[model samples]
Target: MSTYSYRIVNVFTQGDDPFSGNPLCVFESAESLDTPRMQALARQFNLSETTFMLPSTRANARVRIFTPSYEMPFAGHPTLGTAHVCRALGLAGDTLTLEMQAGLIPVYATQRRWTLQASANGPSG
Candidate 1:
């Protein structure tokens, strides 16, 4: 038998209404899941994106973002959403730095909203 837990949140919403924003599924402490399982979970959720939280030696947490079809190194919505989840779960403070494949990204939050400092990836061919 096996068990995994997740939380559903709507990011970038207009207000307190849950349905106003993009829905995301976040898995906490997903260190045990391998790539295939993570992909499967993301597909199962069928949301715009899904995030898996993992342990990080360099940042507050390492996050893996995935869509139903593929994985993304860094994404705006997931980054902000994950940071919000981290704060809510007490894994982070008002500010959070997430380690993604692109690099370490910082996020700051207030009572009303969250902000992320994302570096430009440059033009993609």
Candidate 2:
């Protein structure tokens, strides 16, 4: 028997309203979980998106994004929200570069808000 840690956060939320933002589930230190397990966990959470934090040799962290139904190479809200969680967990610094299947996504954080860069390819991430 084993257990993993996770956190729930609100992404792109309006001030002071818990229901205003897109809810995200971030699985911390998820290097042990495989794709199928991650997908199942995402389905169990049933949020718009869920993210898994993995150790990265090239970037600050490697992020895997999943919906209830499938995996995603990259996503916007999940990226930002996951970055916030990474910083909070000491897994990354204030500015983070996340390695994803699509590409490297950079995120900058302030005390209150976090922002992600739009890749030259487009805004899909």
Candidate 3:
């Protein structure tokens, strides 16, 4: 088997610079986060959302969004947090098109923040 690498991130999603409340849990990777394991962590952390990075052909990573109970097609916070983590690891470009089940959602990074939004005409990439 091939070796895979990933990281777990804690994101506030909202609030001030210092941050408050529970930080969102994320298992970021170029491969994939263990499915059952990621679910378990979601339960343990109990954040609004969590992210898993999967293999992708896009310059941006293929990402899966999950809640504590089930996976999601798309989510604002999870996308942002995932982008932020990836950028921090020097995996970012001016723009990234995350391959989500919903579509090829584009995320752009500016200064120190990451933002994700959907497009009606976006390709299923």
Candidate 4:
């Protein structure tokens, strides 16, 4: 068996409530994981959404979002949550871009708070 590092975070929280907002699980590195493994990991986490981090040629990093049942091209909370993890890992600065299935997303962070710029046309697939 192989070991992987992951972080769980709450997005869109108000004040200091740790339990508030949506819960998300982000895998620090998914260089070795395939689609099946990623799907299984998402199922194992059993959260609304789980994300994996990968190397990117178009942006600071690449992100893949998955639910227990399916993969999503893009998602708001997941994008922000993943961006937060990216910043924590020093993969990118306060302002960075995440390449997603939908398209490229630009994220900005201030401390623990994170935000993403959505595509005007929205996700494609």
Top candidate when judged by TM-score against the true structure: 4
Count the clashes in each prediction: 0, 0, 0, 0
Indicate which candidate wins on lDDT: 4
Cα misplacement distance, residue 95 of candidate 2 (Å): 0.8
lDDT tens per residue, model 2, 33-90: 9999999999999999999999888789989999999999888999999999989988
Give the clashing residue pairs of candidate 2, or none. none
Model 1, stretches more than 4 Å misplaced? 122-125
Instruction: List, residue by residue over 4-122, the lDDT tens digit for candidate 4.
Output: 99999999887888889999999999999999999999999999999999999999999999999999999999999999888889888899999999988988988787777875788
- Model 2 spans with C-alpha error above 4 angstroms: 122-125
lDDT of candidate 2 vs native? 0.89
TM-scores, all models, native as reference: 0.92, 0.91, 0.74, 0.94
Give me candidate 1's TM-score against the actual structure: 0.92
| Candidate 3, 1-125: lDDT as tens digits | 54435445545535555454335555656354567776766676677877777767864688877788987888776777778777776776757777887778888878756666666664355
Judge candidate 1 at residue 74 and give its lDDT.
82
Question: How much is the lDDT of residue 92 in candidate 1?
Answer: 89
Ten-residue stretch with the least lDDT total in model 1: 116-125
Model 1, range 1-125, lDDT digits (tens) per residue? 77898889888888567788888899988989999999999999899899999999988999999999999988889988899889988988998789987888888998758998864662121
- Give the root-mean-square deviation of each candidate in angstroms: 2.9, 2.1, 3.9, 1.7
